[model samples]
Target: MECLASLRTRVHPVVVSAQIASALYDTGLQMVVKERCSDNSTATEEDRQKAISNFYMTYTMLSSLLPFVPAYFLTRYGDRGFRKVPIGIPLLGYLISRTLLLLVILLELPIEVMFGGAVVYGLCGGYSSYWAGVMALESASSQKERRSLCIMGIELAYGIAGFVGSLSSGHIFQIHAIGNKNGVVLVAFCIFLYFLCIIYTFFILVIPGTSAGNVEHRQEGNVGILWNIVEYPRSCNIVIVLLFISAILYDIAVAGGMEMLMSFIMKEPLNWGADQVGYSNAAGFVIFFTSFFGVWLFSKFVADAAMIMIGMVSFAAGIYFMSFVTATYLFYLARSLTLFALIPMPTIRSLLSKQVQPSSYGKILISLQLSFTLASLIYSPIYTKVYQSTLSWFPGFVFLLSSIITVLAIIPISMVGWRMARQEGYVSIEGD
Candidate 1:
């Protein structure tokens, strides 16, 4: 009975709700864009590709710019006892922004109006703040030893929600409402889900009390934490810095590859429709399960840093294979090779959390997310243009580039593993 209560307390209802809403919104918007681009029968396939890609580039760029300051502020506030500040604000943003998409479908608004929606979303701190806040709560609730798995558990909920949502979203999107209005029904459902998420997060959610383990670490005078890593540990700062570098590099590679991939599947031989796109997205979410189990299984034998390398290798190999994929089955086969890919980032966050006091979890995690967003400002547009220019010669060039970059990211984490073993003698915290 006590264990059942504990399990119920750890469950995150809002995370699951928001992710389902997100999956629905993604499919709705993608189909809308496909319709808008195809409205002109005169446009070539490549022309349609460039148009869709351009829309996302501008939308993503807008979304990235306004989040840095707001996310930091929300996270900072959450750290200082306003535990709901980060999550609530972003949920509000999601509600409003998703509403805008609904209006776009129903009222026949220009797609560019989503630029305004993105702005509204960013002002409230976007995904960076929301995810960082959620992780902070998770960190507060668990010991350092099991933090990786605990965090992965939140990701598991998120992925399962995304998978279920994506699997159904395409079918829902085909439902026409109010005089043959396409996606109105789907976008309306998304808004309803977000509304529920906002209410759940702000009203019903209980922020877990800080764990005794986290309190002990904080009392050890590591309050300086990720700001400085620690005082006693030799080369701690170096390890932390390397972790940051590797995380940012890995994120860029993954982000760039995935962004171009949506466009890739929409063109030429693949030319994926709404259902296929949903299935593809569902396939991506399956990795979250495989990766959670991968961590569960692998952590018994290898260190955290080793698990990070294994994930990177998984992704790099999979993405390299993706470079030659020309068929739907081939794409799924490439995706299968990435079974362990989602392990790296959350595991990296778990390691970083171990370095910091609980008070700084939101700050440090938000900072890492913000850093990745900053890097996206540089890479996102470049990925768009590279895909455009290479359309005829090779559309998969970006995937190959991502594979190479993923390999480069492994170097820093490898260095951290060596530094810990040879010098700092940092024991892998597996609880007392």
Candidate 2:
């Protein structure tokens, strides 16, 4: 009974709510684009694709680029007061953005006006700060030995919520009783979820010993922003550096691929409707659960590096298969092949955490998030442009490029495994 109580207290409701909101937003945005693009009967397919591509690029660019500075400040100073500030601020942003979407649908505002919501979301710290605060809260609440388990638990909750939310969003969007707009019901649901997240974060959630006066101060003593970068690498060995490189590459590839995939599926070959898009997204979310299972099953026999390599290969192969997908079944098959696709990033993070001192984990992770955000800024435009340019002849080119980039990530992982094996003075039996 006490164990259950402890578990209940530790479970972050905001995480689940945030995941649901994200899934709804993802599934709903595509529906919104379809509605907006279809409004003009004379618009060609090419024009629709261009408009979709441009809308996504604009939203992605703003959300990714604007969050950097705010996230830095929030993560650095958030510990001074309520630890949940960083986490809660993003939820507030999510609520406002989702509410804006709902209003847009109700008021029949211009679709491009959603960019304003993205801007508001970005200025409020975005996912980078939110996730960082989540990790910090988990770390603070759990014992050192159980920290990883707590993190995994949080991820599992997120995945489950996303899975359910994505599956339902399509049907929700089809509901006609709500204001007669296409996705009004779905957007309203998202707004409600974000509101709950904000309320829970501020009122119901409790961080263990995280009171403003009780928080520990950084020992680095007001060092310049560049100090972490200059100092931390001195401590990281080749394996750590290689791990960082591989993680960043994988992040960029996944981000670009996902952004392109959403737009790609809505176009020529598949032309998926809202329901089909929901199921496709549900398949993607299932990767998280499958990856958790994969890690548990593989950890009994293989090293962490081996597990990461296997995941990378799975992603590469699945993406390669996706490049050939002309039918929905083939797309599902490709998604199935990548069931373990979610493993590498978390595994790499765990390995990197082991390499650095406890005090430096925040610095390392923040730096990683910055790298990912920067990569996102570049990749969104590049992938959008590539997809638009190749829309007529080879729309699958983006997926193929994603596959190639994923395969390239394996090189650094291999180097890291070899270096680690050498350092341990063992015969480097790959995947052993």
Candidate 3:
């Protein structure tokens, strides 16, 4: 757990900064496109749009290659060399990529440079998959003293580091002037850096376990990977169902909240700037940091189901409250409370880990990402359309929808717990 905490301290801020940098980079690229097309009589609007679409399509195609990359390497290598080898690779790659992307953003590279970077960024996603495999080992380790300690450390680190990363991201964007209206150079630089992080992350996963061993858990038949995923065991199936529903709510609520708050409160009504964004994010981080203790406390005294229920109620209230806040300080309050409502994450993860084999960690993590992405991707267009038309309180409705869905999800969570307890012959409602 301590090691995880330390890693989170370092990694969280880095990832958050990367996110900010990436966003700024995209904005810059768009500005460059607009400027280039402005005076070009030979380029029709449709032509310009087509070019932009093609650029994005290329990037998406690159993304399609990422999930399989680490699996390919694992199948090929099987831990023949150094153990810590994979652990250190991604960190170096991240630094290298970040430096290059920073330079590109500062220098404003050509459109093709930015497009080419799409491939490198794609590679970063691939590199991170190596660590995803390690997480399986952590999950599968005996639930004795050492495993629990390790899990706690990891949870703490992820919370704190992620928060710091998020805070730093806003500040770095301001310092680099990457958020300017016209920021092509910044865009290219950011993407390059993102790719670099992917590479660096590749090295961070040094330890290997059963996946690195000679045992073959799954059958040697010709089943497709997708089929394996669909055939998860009963417990994993339940958790996955819950995770999918909860993650969709979580992502849409989070992304929509940030987008709306930043668009509205960060400027005129709030009269704030990048520094304020940093501070506000820092506050959110602190709240998340504090929640680590809440998890510990809950584990010590409260039932797991109780902790989850508390989280659900808190999260519902937090989401509902976010739709109504006005003052800048109050906005911070809302963010903090919402984050506090998320204290059950580690607990939930710990419980869910009991449901699957360690080798399935990559798939589980991918599923989590997929749920969030599915929500974000589907709602993005709808959210945009609503923002264009009903811009007032419409954004609140999005979160409210999440809250409603979350309430519905709690039912299944409770039901599953109830069924589990029944199977174990426990009769009380609080029984686990």
What TM-score fits each model?
0.93, 0.90, 0.64
Segments in model 2 whose C-alpha atoms lie over 4 Å from true places? 1-5, 79-82, 140-149, 209-213, 218-237, 426-432
Q: Which pairs clash in the backbone of model 2?
A: none
Poorest 10 consecutive residues of model 1 by lDDT? 210-219
lDDT of 3 by residue, 165-257 (tens): 455544455443445633434444465655555544443432333244333343222333644666555765775577556545655655544
Clashes of each: 0, 0, 42
Please state the error at residue 145 of candidate 1 in Å.
0.6
lDDT of 1 by residue, 216-324 (tens): 3344355444446445364666778999999999999999999999889888799988899899999999999999999999989988999999999999999999999
Top candidate, metric TM-score? 1
Can you list the residue pairs that collide in candidate 1? none
Those runs of model 3 whose alpha carbons end farther than 4 Å from true positions after fitting are 1-104, 109-119, 123-134, 141-152, 166-205, 208-240, 259-262, 392-395, 426-432
Order of candidate numbers by lDDT, starting with the best? 1, 2, 3
For candidate 2, give the lDDT of residue 81.
38
Ten consecutive residues with minimal summed lDDT in candidate 3? 75-84
- Report every candidate's CA lDDT: 0.88, 0.79, 0.49
